[model samples]
Target: MKTLTEHDIRSSFVNCSKGEAKRLPLPKQLADIDHWDALDFLGWFDLSAPDRSYLVAERGDEVIGVTLRSPSAKRGFLRRSMCSLCLTSHPGSGVSLMSARKAGRAGREGNSVGLYICADLDCSLYVRGKKQPAPGGRMEESLTVEQQIERTRGHLDAFLERLFV
Candidate 1:
């Protein structure tokens, strides 16, 4: 991910309204984020508030952001579940189902799309072997690690694009 200024982040959203973007809280440590290039996507979730999550994904030279809402946080499930974007599994609390309303009129009418994802949205790190894949994920892809990273980003970007279309 490229280093984004406040304006870039607030203006890049494809699925949220301008007012919503303006009001959304930014990471308090924004100036201290030293490694923007190492990030595949920039995201954050509010643990205290639980229902809100935000993401800014890099698509070529452009950035696209979306605001997501989780139905509710289920604190205690015994089973491990896989994140659709990272293809990694974790204890129930490590992943969540987040829904983002569609862009423009569809969103105004309350239409949204949802998917299970890593609670922290660090798929870029997971796919690159920087972070571990879900507990049981196998190195089954014949592609090199670099290729896998690119593929994962492609899948993630495609999902984000759907919110706009």
Candidate 2:
């Protein structure tokens, strides 16, 4: 993982709204962060929740950022009662609330862990894919855009595994 600055981290995002991304609290060790290892940073609103948190990871500063929100009592997505990170198909909609489970050695003593990912496919890149058509309307040829997205999803899954288990 390569190190990154708050500015670099903020500038890297392409999913969330610019205003919302800028408002997020920079990680305490932003200067020390490995931006290359970071897949991406995650941030959301706090209007009806506690303080906002940012999780950033990079793969040589060239991968999708993996982010998890801090634990909150309001239970935005967590209230769904499903694993937000899970995407397995179920008979009914399985929306689960994201819980901050303790991670690493610190998790044993009441550390934060887990988060609410879409029970279905992750909604981020999916939306992007749907909006953008293949170049020259060619579906057979592989494009850099498709490759980047595929790699990003792989990185996201790996990061979630590391954070959760």
Candidate 3:
């Protein structure tokens, strides 16, 4: 991953109108992010619009971005959920089900794809131990950190591929 600018991110969106992308709130302190090289994608929830979220990733030479939405009702707090991307288990509502509108005609017809992901969109950090989940949240794995990162990226790429279907 490489450091990206606001313009780069805004222009990378594939599933939303340019105007909507322009209005979408970016992650705060874009310039201050020190983990660019560690990220497979940039993802964040919109604080101003609770149901809205965004993700941007580099695929080959192009950067692809998508708009995602989460249900208004929160998930149950008593259940532990695992992120499909990083396979990290989080207690309670720490995992969220987020759906992205498909690109092209499918999207116009209200078609979308969903996945269970980290609520904070910090899969990269979690896989690398740069961030921690609740006590006993992380499962012990035989895979090394690099393997975990690769698995996470593979999951994300598969999700992104679904946007075009």
Candidate 4:
């Protein structure tokens, strides 16, 4: 994957208004993100960063397709008894926090860190009850939701590692 600039990302968006894309605050680390490894991004914008700042990504410029990530946080969503990715009922303590970014600068290098954790599971889709596709036929019989989540986590970890070293 090829890293993208704020301008590149904004231009790729098919649905959002140019004004909105331009106005959206670029992550101060915008130059720091590994835009290439990112999947079909819907959209991206900076999240306030002192303790933890994030860059939200979506399949389009619209809010409908989105994912939020914070390099500083290393934590995703909220803590829960179950795994949103796998839907496994862990003891609310088995979850993990993952973070990935470009290596040297946001886009200059590729490095990411992920921790097996028990943190808040606050993502809108996961919280509200939506399932993303796993590698198998379905989340039910094909592969456990936990496996799916792990798979994504692995992908993220690898991407991060690629960025890091």
Q: Per-residue lDDT for 1-165 in model 4, tens only? A: 345565665554222345745655554565665533433222233444322322233322321211234334333324334443334343323344444334345433333444332234323233223533223212244655455545644543443344434
After the best TM-score superposition of candidate 2, give how far the Cα of residue 140 lies from its true spot, in angstroms. 44
- TM-score for each predicted model, relative to the true structure: 0.88, 0.34, 0.96, 0.31
RMSD of each: 2.1, 15.3, 1.0, 14.6
lDDT of 4 at 123: 30
Q: Would you give me the overall lDDT of model 1?
A: 0.79
| Candidate 2 positional error at 17, Å | 1.1
Give the higher-TM-score candidate: 1 or 4: 1
Q: What are the clash counts of all predictions, listed in order?
A: 0, 36, 0, 31
lDDT of each: 0.79, 0.42, 0.91, 0.38
Ranking by lDDT: 3, 1, 2, 4
Query: How does candidate 3 score on lDDT?
Result: 0.91
Q: Candidate 1 clashing pairs?
A: none
Best candidate according to TM-score: 3
For candidate 2, which ten residues in a row score worst on lDDT? 83-92
Q: Per-residue lDDT of 18-83 in model 3, one digit per residue for the tens?
A: 999999999998889988999989998798999889999988788999999987888777899999
lDDT tens per residue, model 1, 5-92: 8898899887877997998888768789887876778888765577998988778888888888876747576778777886777776
Question: By TM-score, how accurate is candidate 3?
Answer: 0.96
